[model samples]
Target: MPPNPDLRQTIDVAPGLDLAATLGPLRLGVSDPCWRVEASGPWWWATRTPAGPLTVHLVPGAGVVGVEAWGEGVEWLPRHLGRLLGLDADGPPAARTELVRALAQRVPGFRVAGHGRVADAAIDGICRRGVSAFEAARSWLLMVEAMGDDAPGPGGLRLPPAPRRVASCDPYELHVMGLEQGRADEVRRVASHASRLEAGTHDGGAEAIAHLAGIAGIGTDAVEHARAVALGDPDAVPVLDAHRTAAVVRALWTGAGADDTVDVRSLLEPHRPERGLLVRLIALVEAADAADDDGGLTP
Candidate 1:
């Protein structure tokens, strides 16, 4: 055979862009089946797309992010690659404040990555709302394993359930998996409207986020979470769970955690359009500090 060539697209990135910091957020956990970053370097993802399931490989260099893929989703994958890696929006709006300057120095080359697959993003984000990280991860895995199709081009990877698969599920069945009754109902509703949600990604900006208001069960947290990944808002903040909120709070006030999105938004106001990106950078730093066994003193 010669060569098959659906793959197309390259993203010019800053030198030393930390792929791990960028893409780590996509996985539900280190064991998440949707994605992997090899110890040697390359990143791989088994993702759902508007066209279908795709297995994507990303190779990073000094100023470019190379792309390769195989499966039904190939045609649609290239179009959304930029948003997939959270490169859709421009970076910080210029570091004019002291805090901005400090964060810049503290977390150089930090980039937040999100898989801009609308319906899929909505599923993951909605699953995570109002739950413990552990519970959320388990819930997500349960749903995927139970309803998702076998991915076409990768080993040990499962596609996120298609809208039809999810929409057809009985809400009670989902509840048994981990979601509460309300959230389970929300999942079904979202699945029923997956196509519309997917279309919103194309709408972009406030209009897209605004469309979520019509959804009954999707609350502010879920909408914001969906916005982060679906819209590829680099500044998309997803205080993943209370731990993240605690970390952000600890970094700011050196005390207990605060679950107030309003206050957190206020605290991060100076970062402006980059607030979402800023949180990711801080979370990365906090995780690193935790790895050092210093109890993660800073975010």
Candidate 2:
């Protein structure tokens, strides 16, 4: 049968943009339960909006990101397309320092993609706390598989459970999914207040972070990560892990050690609002180098 009719829209974008580089950070993995990316092709994302479940497929062409969506929230994706792709970001402010300039050159077209929903970002942030990226991704995939619903597409995808659904989950069940009791509780707390959190996505996320930080297990780092990923707060810097800290130190400060108490903000002062984007680019460059050294293996 021909593909079922679906609500769709195409958005023309600037030429030379790497859709993958712009959107890849949002995908947890190739087999991520919430999103799927066809190698060098389209990106499919599944989520539960306030209206209902939705699946959006993003395809990049000569100068556009084509969007095909299905389900009750089809219009929601297009409504926030600009924010999702960072179309409004005024590229990096003129790079002042040599380090910032070089780093910018290394990762061109790298945009900070936003989730457009504070609840989604908050849940991802909660899962990522005090864990390796691999572990965090695993927890996310497992939790979604256990709690999410089948997506409304041909890709055999799944939509993450609505916050209300997750909020109502039994802690013991979540514990079985490898979430410790504390983290599970944190997830529930955020989910229970998901509506309030969703409203906080506006105003650049200061309100969202403040609201979430009040909950146990959600800290400054988690709040920052959520703000950057969900609210598109250009200045939000994610809490870095040991390896990332070392990488930043080596890349920016020639002889600085990881324990040198480096003032990260000062290093990127010239790039104030774009600091988060700059940081992600540096991390991308580091990841690329490591991949090359490991014979193109990727984590």
Candidate 3:
């Protein structure tokens, strides 16, 4: 029987969110086809199927309250999605020191927390490689809706898909999702072994990276990205990509320097052992809607 789709109920969109800016960029401004989110907190959008475009916006501190679905069950949002999307209510220490200070100065909504989402991070990395941000987001929507599990949250909304289910997906299925074979293969490979690597933040930082890197299509940058989802390891520097790199430079040096040629290690040297924390702190501070530009100073 086809799974029922109207099982979600009760979502409290957290107060104090600047929906206009945050939701737009965070959700790639509707660039992703499978999912479309509104600029309202605690709002819900139903999918054509349990696996189709499902969007949920809850209060900053709000959580799941109820759920009801057709095809499969829905409960608990995926940890990985939270990590990549910066949805976790809590924050973690930065990987670099200067990042800690810089973040302390910029990026208001950023937080420091352990890794949250495993599958989303892996799939996002693969699908995004060599593609435009819009293309990657679209591919993600296609891939997840096709293979992901439905978990109920605060309003009975199903969370992103599960790793086990994703691992078993066929390449052709991803093609149906509008994804090419190579990206699909990468997603499968990462999802296949997600369990071994999804070992919570405080526990599996280094090990998870090594394991993720072992998969085909995954590289140093990919592994670091996974670590961010898995452990929220603040130090998981994404030095490979151009956009993130540019963001890093701009956030770090306040310059619109080219990301392609920048060196991650050299840039992060200022923070040393605590670079990750600093970077995230900067992001968090910058994300804040109301800021004095003094970077929250007591002076």
lDDT against the true structure, per candidate, is 0.70, 0.73, 0.49
The per-residue C-alpha lDDT of model 3 at residue 211 equals 70
Q: lDDT for model 2, on a 0 to 1 scale?
A: 0.73
List clashing residue pairs in candidate 1: 235-276, 235-277, 236-276
Question: Which of the two candidates, 1 or 3, achieves a greater lDDT against the reference?
Answer: 1
Report the C-alpha displacement of residue 50, candidate 2, in angstroms: 1.5
Q: Please write out the lDDT profile of model 1 over residues 1-299, one tens digit for every residue.
A: 52343574678877777677778777776756777777767788887766877888888887888887878889877666766665654553255566556776665666555576656677777777777788888888888888887766544477887679789988888989888888888788778877666533445635646666588777676677777766657566763677777666666653355445436676777677777766776777778867678664522
Residue 217, candidate 3: Cα error in Å is 5.0
Instruction: Give candidates' CA RMSD values in order.
Output: 3.8, 3.0, 7.8
So what's the TM-score on candidate 3?
0.59
Poorest 10 consecutive residues of model 3 by lDDT? 42-51
- How do all models score by TM-score? 0.85, 0.86, 0.59
What is the lDDT for 227 in model 1?
A: 70
Winning candidate number (TM-score) = 2
Tens-digit per-residue lDDT, 142-170, candidate 2: 88887788988776789875677789989
Top candidate by lDDT: 2
